[model samples]
Target: MEILKVKHLRKTYHTKKHEILAVEDFSFNLKQGEFVAIVGPSGCGKSTILSILCGLDKPSSGTIEINNNLKFGYMLQGDNLFEWRTIYKNCLIGLELENKLTKENLDYVNHLLDTYGLKDFKKAYPNNLSGGMRQRVSLIRTLATKPDILFLDEPFSALDYQTRLAVSDDVYKIIKKEKKSAIMVTHDLSEAISMADRVIVMSPRPSTIKNIYEIKLTGKSTPIQNRKAKEFADYYDKIWKDIDYHV
Candidate 1:
């Protein structure tokens, strides 16, 4: 089932002297359990479109149709976990701020921690965990509110290359295990090809969809394992050329 639809999306930045067009005519549909990754030139407004979809920013001209039953959760680049707060408390912060920290919601958060290998570290601070572990906790925190779809913007960019690979695998497993859909904006072609069902490639500054590839691997598993798929490099090369051509 289609869960979200965006059409004719465009954003413009107005300066005192002139106007700058960032994105134009971006359109796509997100399925109920699909994972979509978007890649483009650095300043092509890839993140801008994500911001509009997740309600952090408004599109100057567009239509976003979200299923009434779906809710959104956004995870930014780094872990951003609070150092002073315990891991459990960090997860509950969202529910607390929204005044939805009921017994049921609290129990749900606890269940996520226990299910995702963070049971022993509930009381531990963010600084006490490895970079990969912290990213896992950050994901649980995002899941705490029970969002139906996640909007990720360069989610693993802050981690070291090794940690980034491990964290991507961790995050992919978590999202699949929870049966959630996601739309992510990432610059890494390999990451996008390995983790997404469809990869959207956009043009420069006045961003628009150049192409969309449906990633199909011989045998799909975790993100790391998916990297070894027979068809992986082919998809990567095509996507790389598409974006490279635009650049």
Candidate 2:
């Protein structure tokens, strides 16, 4: 089933100097349970598309139909955790704000906390945890809202190389285990190749769908392991060339 659809989407920013066309004729259909990655050159409007989908921004022209009744939860480039709140409190902040707190909801939150290795650190502050743990908490907080779709905007970009790889694998597993659909905007070609079932390539400024590549691989592996697959380099090389053309 189609969980999300974007038809002829366009977004333009009006400025004193000129009207910048950030996104143009963008369209795609996302399947239920699909993890799709969109990659492009920097300043190419990848985040614009994510922002519009998450309802943080509006597209100047187009149609977006999200099939589910639940709202989306967005994760930005950084953890965005509250310094004042404890880790557990930060995770439950969404429920408290929505006035949706309940015993059942709290129980569910506790279950996620324990399942995702945050149980011991529940009382700790965000500042005490490592970057990866903070990101995990950010995701758990997003998940606490019971969102039907999740929008991730380069959530792993700020991490160190080794931590990024491990965290990417962990996040991938968590999203899949939770049975959620995600749209991730990233510039890392290997990341796009590793975690996505389909990789959407965008052109430079005034971005549009350049192409979409289907990835076929077997077995479960970390992003690093996935990168080591025999066909990995071939896919990498092709996407590298495709985006290199625009750069």
Candidate 3:
């Protein structure tokens, strides 16, 4: 099932003296329960695409069809959790805003917290948790809304290398376990290769899809493990060369 479809997507920023096109003729369809990663160079309008999809910004010309009857949840580069809110409260923020904070929803959030090793820290403040834990809380908050699609924009870039790998695995597992679909914009080729079912490489601004690689592998492995898979280096080399071609 196709959850979302984009046709001839374009984003043009109009300014006093110039109009800059960020993305042009970007079109794709995302299937249900699929994880798709988009990679591009800096200033290639990665965030612009996400913003337009989320209705935070309007595209110059395009059509986005969301076939699902669920809201879209966005996770930015930072954790985006309110520092003053406790972990549990942070998770409830979405529910509160949507006026859907019922006991059932709160219980579901609690279940996620407990299942994810955050049970004991529910009452703790965000400042008390590690970077990864904070990110988990942020994801829980996004999931609390029960979105049909998740938009993640480099949510792990702020973490250290070791922490990023661990958190990437955790997040990948959590999303799969929950059976949620996601579209992520990332510059990390390894991260994109490890997390996405398909990785779409884009050209510089105005960004356009240059190539899309379907990652094929055997067995479930950690991102680090996936990186070391026999076929992993082949993908890395191929994607590297592809992106380099655009550069």
User: For model 1, how does the per-residue alpha-carbon lDDT over 1-247 read when each residue is reduced to its tens digit?
Assistant: 9999999999999999989899988999999999999998899999899999999999999899999968899998888899999999999888988899899999999999998898999999998999888988889989999999999999998899999998898899889889999999998999999999999999998889999999989888888999999999899888888888542
What candidate 1 gets wrong by more than 4 Å, as runs, is 245-247
With a 3 Å backbone cut-off (N, CA, C), the pairs that clash in candidate 3 are: none
What lDDT does the true structure give each of the candidates? 0.92, 0.90, 0.89
What's the C-alpha lDDT at position 217 in model 2?
Answer: 62
Per-residue C-alpha lDDT of model 2 across residues 64-87, encoded as one tens digit per residue: 998857579889998989998999
Ten contiguous residues with the weakest lDDT in model 1: 238-247
Q: Which tens-of-lDDT digit does each residue in 108-219 have in candidate 3?
A: 9999999998999999999999999999999999999898789999999989989999899999999999999999999899999988999988888988998999999676
Candidate 2 matches the true fold with a TM-score of 0.96
Instruction: Give each model a TM-score.
Output: 0.97, 0.96, 0.96
Off by over 4 Å in 3: 245-247
What's the ranking of the predictions by lDDT, best on top?
A: 1, 2, 3
What order do you get sorting by TM-score, best first? 1, 3, 2
Candidate 3 structure, TM-score to reference: 0.96
**lDDT score, candidate 1, position 144:** 91
